[model samples]
Target: MCLNLKKGAIFVADSHFSEVNVEFLSFLEKLKKKEIETSQLFLMGDMFDFISGESRYFVKINQKLIDIINELSHNIEIIYLEGNHDYNLQKLFPKLKVYKRESQPIFAKYENKTIALAHGDIYTPKGYDIYCKIIRNSALLIFLNFIDFNYWLSKKIYNKLIKKSICSKMKDFDSFAKKRLSYYNSDIVVEGHFHQGKHYEEKNKLYVNIPSLCCNKKYTIFDGKFITTQL
Candidate 1:
């Protein structure tokens, strides 16, 4: 979601962190150890490969990373915009400000410019929209949790996700972004989901695709303009 930037904020996205990705856990450890300093931490989404609040098994699976985040939240202003892969997190990270897909394009002021923040999966087809709603529902999540945690359903889902390729080059991305920006009322749109890690400017409006921390160890900092850097 949107937050006014009083100081530099670290924006991380599409990390797709899981049990296999020890790097993501290390990054959390660094943040917890004060190696990575920031007044604000923006989790742009998909930070977890698959995490839900309803499932105790999934919570235990990522407990180390979750604990680090929970500890850091005591001091840092952490904002989590739930991604496709990571939703239903309100129960998991109660201290952090969690934004769901429907509540996005959260608006904020950045140096006299209005900024909109989202997980970048908005304005999709009607079918996908419905799917998002169903999946994020509390009742549905509880039902899934019953089956997933009791059985080995979580393992099956995790296996499928791990096999899929998350990194890819989006052809004609400028055109795609141009169309997306037209739906926004802000001067700048910052989002992450496509894992493109690219910036685009058109008609004085800026669109930032924040880099994935899992992909090339990339992250972004806002210093007047968004700056992309590697860890």
Candidate 2:
């Protein structure tokens, strides 16, 4: 399906929400209270540090933000593109539009532009590709869910992720991005996961790397162009 990119659409990427980082929660609260308003919301990816629909422990921990999002979905349009840290979300978010990693680079139309949206993990090295597939495999997730003991494994993973550093500036990002952009066939390519929040243009094609909301306290609004703003 080709999504129509509306004016004032809000896009949030890599919030990495956990007990330690509650910035995303507060942002959601503002949206819920109508302090911030938008007709469309795009959850680019990794909105949580570690979340899976099959994991009951993870669900229990992140229920507050989940609930608010589900409630908001009733009145507005929300598209959630699953990232490395969060996936298998179709069940957990029945009301919202959920797109898994494989189904990404979804096409959208904005004025005369054909935009490609993804979680930004595609066209990776072979080793990383295998790792992503293994991690996102439903069979593996089910097996882990079956073996989890009192949520011990889940807690360990969450604790580790909450403490890890995820922000950095890439060396020669322009060159790196150009290589990636070569793989896309769109007027604009938008993605999250790199945490760089860069905007680049080469040969008339625009590449937007949304900033990590957790690291930058920033989110994006799409009007005629992509706008990054602090919360």
Candidate 3:
């Protein structure tokens, strides 16, 4: 979908994979070359793997990574749409702009597209409140981050496990999105949380299933022209 953006056009994302993949980081660098700092970055959910144990907000990215962001702070506005894993968003550091919401519809006239940015966790028929509690304090998350977090292999494995767990479609939230889209009838609905990367479209509608790609395979981007990229 071509939502032609203004220079204010930015990047939207979810489940930031982290500094594990060389290829992905290279991709980010390429975008950075275009000026990542000056652009805005919207995170749909799961920006990091801090859903657990010891702290209110745990960061997988350490000093070096924080340093990288400090460098880009001047040029970008980083916003985060809270996901099940990252419920206590207000606790997230200043760098992450966490929106305490279930979902929201955004209008990008400059890009000529209407975007529904949700972390995709609401799909659970039961509810996110329950899931959030259990997932938030896993010993594994704590142990892993304490040791060698961000190792590509471990992250890949983690992603695989998360996928397997979402085997059943959470119709409640899914239908919620569909209904909302009908209400807004936006040009596109881009979402993440399922960790599945794909796109769906109708005559006047589009639904984007964003993958939980780490910082490397990160999927959304925008230029002065439009908001377009592969998930």
Candidate 4:
């Protein structure tokens, strides 16, 4: 059986929360305070600048947002698709459904149409695939955690991440979308990695590259069709 995609569900992608980009923190605050409401929440990832379950230092620094998300999960359904910047999160978020990259393009049924969801990192080159595997390896993360004792190594990495620019427009996005569609057979293809907030029809199939909350200050609401709303 396919998952049910609920109406009024909210989809957030690539917030990239860090010391510099705190828009996601405010968004979470609104959710916690009931300023915004949704029965289903889809976190289409890169939700953090960097994070992993085995990295104690990163987890500790991000504990506040983590606590709020854990609390919210009890009252709502949350589906998180792990992106490159964030993975190994099953232990961190036991209440939510977390899909790792290896298990992506998860299918759901929405209004009799098939919907596919991913973090937009698949169909990548072999080198990137190998890098993703190595980065998410538990042993390597544990070793990094050991080096991050006293927040030394982790702090440097965090500083660099926050300074890096992530917002940019893609060239030839129309062709890019068409090429990407060649890999999927679903009625709707939804992803968030390019940081491009765009939706268009190709071969009668809906393609939605969800907006980056950090870049666009927007998120998407799905009733029958996708609607992008500003913060």
Q: Quick one: how many clashes does candidate 2 have? A: 0
> lDDT tens string, model 3, 105-196?
44445445555566755434566657555555547455655665446545564566444433234445555446545655567666666654
- Tens digits of per-residue lDDT for model 4 on 1-231? 368999999999999999888988999999999999999999999999989998888898899998999999999899999999999999999999999999998999987799989999999999999999999999999987777768889889899998899999998888888877778989999999999999868778988999999999999999788999987
Which candidate should be chosen as best, given lDDT against the real structure? Answer: 4
Tell me model 1's lDDT, rounded to 2 decimals. 0.85
Give candidate 1's error at residue 175 in angstroms. Answer: 1.3
**Candidate 1: residue 156 lDDT (0-100):** 85
CA RMSD of each candidate after superposition: 1.5, 1.1, 7.1, 0.9
Better of 2 and 4 by lDDT: 4
TM-score for predicted model 1 compared with the true structure: 0.95
lDDT of 3 at 44: 67
lDDT of 2 by residue, 1-231 (tens): 999999999999999998877889988999999998999999999999989888888999899888999999999899999999999998988988999888988999988989999999887789998899899888888889888889888888888887898888998889978977899999999999999988989989999999999889999998888999989
Q: Which TM-score value belongs to model 3? A: 0.58
> Which sections of candidate 4 miss by over 4 Å?
none
**lDDT digits (tens) for residues 16-98 of candidate 1:** 98755556777778788788788899999899898888867778788888988988999999999999989989888989999
TM-score of each: 0.95, 0.97, 0.58, 0.98
